[model samples]
Target: MPFILTRITRDGLSRLMAKYVVGQIVCHERGWMDTHMKQIKKDCIGWHTFHSFRSLDQLTVGVMGLGKIGLTTAKVLKGFGCRVHGLVRTPRSHSSVEPFVDQLWHGREGLADFLKDCDYLVNLMPSTPLTHGLLGDEVLTGASRRPVIVNVGRGDIITEADLLKALEQGWIFAAVLDCYEKEPIPEDSFLWTHPRVVMTPHNSYNNNEDYKRHHIQTEFIVNFENFLAGQPLTGEVDWQTGY
Candidate 1:
């Protein structure tokens, strides 16, 4: 980390400083901590290990949706040291997370298991008719503990009420949400006011920008190279599933 040169909002010096630093500068608004007391509180807790925190040690991390981010997150957790469990509609659909997860559960039955005690349970599904409010009272109220409740998928999957109940009931230790049911989230929404909640503007792929950009560029480069070489293009598309 390097020194930060901050200025009053009216000075416009921040923008001037930004031009000079380019990617090196990371700016934050003033009174950021006041806006992030829950995180401040959650971080205040000392780090613990599985052996020490028996419950934490046997962390049964659950992923509600094994989509791109969810699958990748499960993989990372497994590699960094954690037991993973995944839930999806079809057992055969998600082979990417298979090796990382200790177990896989499907359908309502499998989804029910996600409510059980776990160190972390992250929802990385989407916001479709079938997924709306999916994490209602049944799953939210049933969880053994909050399990560090995190929702990176769509916000509406779990209603605001359910989230409140989970916290009030001690279903989980903390809440970290990147996306919410309402984009930009209502200024007065409880998601911000909740004592256990941590909110972000959906930056899960922050570190993947270069990889993403390269892939797009590669797609174009590959096709152009193939044309020059007189070779067939190599890309599959399943319009039916929209993948």
Candidate 2:
């Protein structure tokens, strides 16, 4: 038997994650969570004095990692009239992402400068040695604007301890996390009770078994047909890149 893998849901997952990121930003900026809690606890209503609230178009969003998902996220944000910036480890030739971003920062040397200009920092990078702890003190401290950190990527990019310190030190405003250093986060984890944090199980991608099975079968059939026709397949993973 031969093993086959397909990323038939990559685009859908990216769009879903983008929506989550935008929703978190709106919730944080508009104080929706706090207001909801107060309404439930104190029976308060009509308390809508939000000093820090701002529209999405007024914010500058920085996206780390400009792969397929990152590019999709950027495109969605751009559609909302946001000033989007993208970061990559190296430069690409004639990249499709260029038209979606207002600025592009290349290499680690520019990370600090990039962080300084962002009102929201979205992380969509993969798990690799170079990306481990990449969002710790050194990089986060450069966020002079105190951007809200949104991590829909691998959790190991920033240590939980460092994330708390960054929040306490005022390096970043808050965090919206879908992934964590540990899954199902420990019962005693500070993140569970942190007021400035929002946690979600690693479900940015839809996990409906029926929907997934349908897509997988469709992708496989399409690829099999293409193979028979001596045509290229979609989502051919490169082992060396580990995508």
Name the candidate that leads on TM-score.
Answer: 2
Query: Lowest summed-lDDT stretch of 10 residues in model 1?
Result: 20-29
Question: How good is model 2 by TM-score?
Answer: 0.87
Report lDDT per candidate. 0.59, 0.83
Q: Which ranges of candidate 1 are over 4 A from the true structure?
A: 1-57, 93-97, 207-212, 216-243
Best model per lDDT: 2
User: lDDT by residue for model 2 over 17-133, one digit each (tens)?
Assistant: 788888888888888888888777774554554547889999999999988888888988888889998888767643557678888887677787788889999999988777888
Question: Across residues 62-149, which tens digit of lDDT does each residue of candidate 1 receive?
Answer: 8777654556566656664567888875565446567877777786766767567566667766566667777777576566655676
Clash pairs for candidate 2: none
Residue-level lDDT for 150 in candidate 2: 91
Would you estimate the TM-scores of all the predictions?
0.64, 0.87
Every model's Cα RMSD, please? 12.7, 2.9
